[model samples]
Target: MTTRHQLALGACTVTVAALTSTLLVTPDGATAATGPDRIHDIQGDHRISPYAGDSVADVPGIVTGVRTEGSAGFWMQDPRGDDSPATSEGVFVFTDAKPPVQPGDEVRVSGQVSEYVPGGADSGNQSVTQLTDPTVDVRSSDQPLPEARELNAGTVPETYAPQGDPAEDDSIDGLRLRPDRYALDRYESLEGMNVQVEDTRVVGPSSEYDDLWVTVRPDEHPTARGGTLYGSYASQNPGRLKVTSLAPSEEGFPAADVGDQLTGTTAGPLDYDQHGGYHLAARELGTLRDSGPSPERTRPQRDGELAVATYNVENLAPDDDATKYERLAQGVVRNLATPDILALEEVQDDSGAQDDGTVTSERTVGKLIDAISEAGGPRYEWRGIAPRDGQDGGQPGGNIRSGFLFNPERVSFTDRPGGDATTATEVVQRDGQATLSHSPGRITPNDPAWKDSRKPLAGEFRFRSEPVIVVANHFSSKGGDQPLHGSTQPPKRSSEKQRHQQARQVNAFVQDIQDVRRKADVVVLGDLNDFDFSATTSALTENDALRGAAATLPEEERYTYVFQGNSQVLDQTLVSPGVSRFDYDIVHTNAEYADQVSDHDPQVLRFRP
Candidate 1:
């Protein structure tokens, strides 16, 4: 249950690049006193700075942007206008020695007007009024680019969190940022200034430094393939930002995907970073076009019925990635129409993450059943239990477990024995019905709410003749929780009591098989990282013995994953009551379409037994 868009780049790519400045301006025609004390009087009206620690000198404005890489610096801006929408006529002139300045020039600078706060001063970060060691004087050089600040369309700010009060663990929300109802307080009322955004679409996907995440108002949360539908939080669509990229060696940035737009008018400056929060460091880039058709769905076949998918294949093993095991067997045969009975979460093993333990994934389930019989589907026949080699955590030699894949010509696998792997799958009652003697086994796996976690497994098929079973799960992750917007407020989900006691011990082993057989057709699905409006899914559907198949869609299509833009539901499936209704959907293929294969967005269900 850990698919938080797994691209894994721990950090270091927030650069919006253009910071060059060797302080040059000292030419003799000198001038040092401008007047209305400009650069928005050291960017005040709040957010630190009444001249910070003062050393003030001449302050004028007009450089507009430079950044010769890493933390170099330049960004001025004072064409005029002080009606103060919480003052911010842009600043940042901290220099290094002295020499080359361009973009509109007109300078002045001086030194020591600090207020910096980048990663210091108690580090909750976000301060930057800068001017340190500065020198500059230029007073003139092609002064044109200034009327920029355009964020258009309905003036943004529909709240993305900040109902005030709540702050601490990693922090946020000590309130007072109402810069007009949120969008991170209207980007902290023009923090660091100089902005733009026009027609910027692209909803996240070109990373490894080409950075992305646009939407300069592509009609806010519009879904159905046009991108941007992460809903809830009072429609906070301050017209998406985060674009970062420093001319990646000139002309090499176009792998975009979602609703793709980025062609012109992106401007830049507004920074406030800790890795993607109010970013726009984009000095100028547009032209991506291709508004895609790849948000595809429709493939949950119904004829000759038997579907059941679950896919958290984000970590499949067998020497891993061979084109993501042929693009997850073309999303399990052209997008899940081949789910005879899948489940397969994380998988791994056969030397994948190299933890030296070598727990089996049977060549990672024989390269996804030989790439789902070379993508024409059906050859399946798999089963799992593994663990004990690494107590079931994940990615350390890739021992990830939870599995079962079927289509033995449409179900059968009774396996009847105790399928080991450190044991647990009970609820016997042989002739009284119920089942699971060890079909695929591993449930309580030496309890302690199943230690390092991933122990659910079960399986015991038979389909049409009735008696299904399933289970699968890959729980225990909210990876250290506490985030739904910080400073704690309502955050602190510190792994919701170990996923609410692993959903009450998988609801007491599914109430010990519907109290020893009572129409037992169960399911339970994968990646239950919690949410279906969580409480760890009300301890797995509390009084109802199991339910959520995304509570049956609608409520704006009950999500499958999305993060940052919300469409929340950490992959579900549940079922059980009358055991019938399992015709589920969510095959939106890969969490919000990136250059995808799996960050999990798969889920089929379908039933006709």
Candidate 2:
């Protein structure tokens, strides 16, 4: 959850090796060029400049915006408009801190046109057109900055794909963006242009980077959780735009969550680069107001049924001070309504990221248990078999693993013979009752499918005298996969193959018991790292005897994680056919908030075993 994709935007060293032949500069840093060096010509229709790598003498324009902080630079625009949608008139003039130019100053800048990819080139991101290593002479000051281009209804269409061939060869990157046809193209057309969106609704919460995603008027894809819901591949809400604050250090902008609306207007230069598509680099940000959606806590536990919850507490460790542990415990007690049994993933060893080969997490879970008790919740007794020292692919030496935290007063671990982390568990029938031969054992831990990933931990439990077995899982993550907006159409989920194998293994284990006792009341729950509609999820419940708990909610509401502007499902609770789920909810305190404790939201399932 703490991992950020931001790249390092180091200031490039100045080199005048590509100065244009016609360029001439006086000792006073004043330079002038007549033709070809105009701002529009430098910023050609394509992303790469026609004069890229060539230092021009006098690129004349009016400074539209001045960035005084962090790799300080100023933006300039051609006073005369360019009619072509593909051609951008505004361009960034990169320089050292606090350039002499101010907004609304018409100046003649001498610089090299460069394709500077913000963050870094290794980030697998697109490049932003900019003029770098600049020397500017202010021709005039206090001139009107270009008008803020307005975006309203129908300007940005609802379609994600432009009308064309949807193959790799016909990707959006290759096409001459048609602003009138697709929303992405519309923003691409206005790249670096001063733009404004009135009365925008903040769909994504502001992150530590002080950036948030917003949707302009006429987009109805907003979710109750304050994200733009992509219903299908075609339901792309073009009104959605990311906003990066230029004034984050400014006080009084209380933290904004999902469903909060920014009133008035946000005017700034339209920017397109890495960091998940087009955004408005707003200079004049609007006021943020609460949009009425609030944090949600699951219902209180009821009699005759036990509540089970699953959460991946993002590499939680004991040394994280007391704040993180306390917040998580409070989230469980309040947001999760104190589930009787909690399945946790990514529980790092007591040493956390330290590589001292400490593979036990007793201190980690114990601290959380103490916090829970301090928060007025029942004391939870946790159990797990520490994985082989460095086998798990999580934090090295930390040996991240999945485990169970149950209210011992309401539930008790049913320990049988033969339990260890290395050996696989077998299904054995004892006195006509279906049970794991090795209670609280690892499921196929040595299997190649679990190589470097958390092996599923199986444990048999007695909840109010009803025998039930639950499997805690933390599947392979979806990293290193192609992005949806990448050149590849529909993108490839390379991580799904391992997750599918893991799912099949779990499904086979569940099927083993269902063959003998069709109503065994077994439950499989945790961070599966795949959506409910994914093939991995299909393989998990392929047997008619089991079903996913999220299926009970409306299809649009079956989400446990949010990405970009889309709310998705990654965590799940699957129960046997006879174990009907009376109540199922995804606690919404996390995932949609910037101050979230976990990237994946906790799911609570209530059922009678």
Best by lDDT: 2
Model 1 RMSD in Å is: 20.6
For residues 389-463, could you state the per-residue lDDT of candidate 1 as single tens digits? 878787676778888888888788788776788877788888888987777888777878768878888888887
Candidate 1 lDDT trough over 10 residues, lowest sum:
6-15
Q: What is the lDDT of residue 543 in candidate 1?
A: 71
C-alpha TM-score for every candidate: 0.36, 0.89
For residues 279-392, could you state the per-residue lDDT of candidate 2 as single tens digits? 787778888888736678888888878888899999998789788888998998888888888999999998988988788888999999999999989999988889888887
lDDT of each: 0.70, 0.76
Model 2, runs deviating above 4 Å: 1-21, 24-35, 47-57, 69-71, 118-122, 163-171, 231-236, 252-254
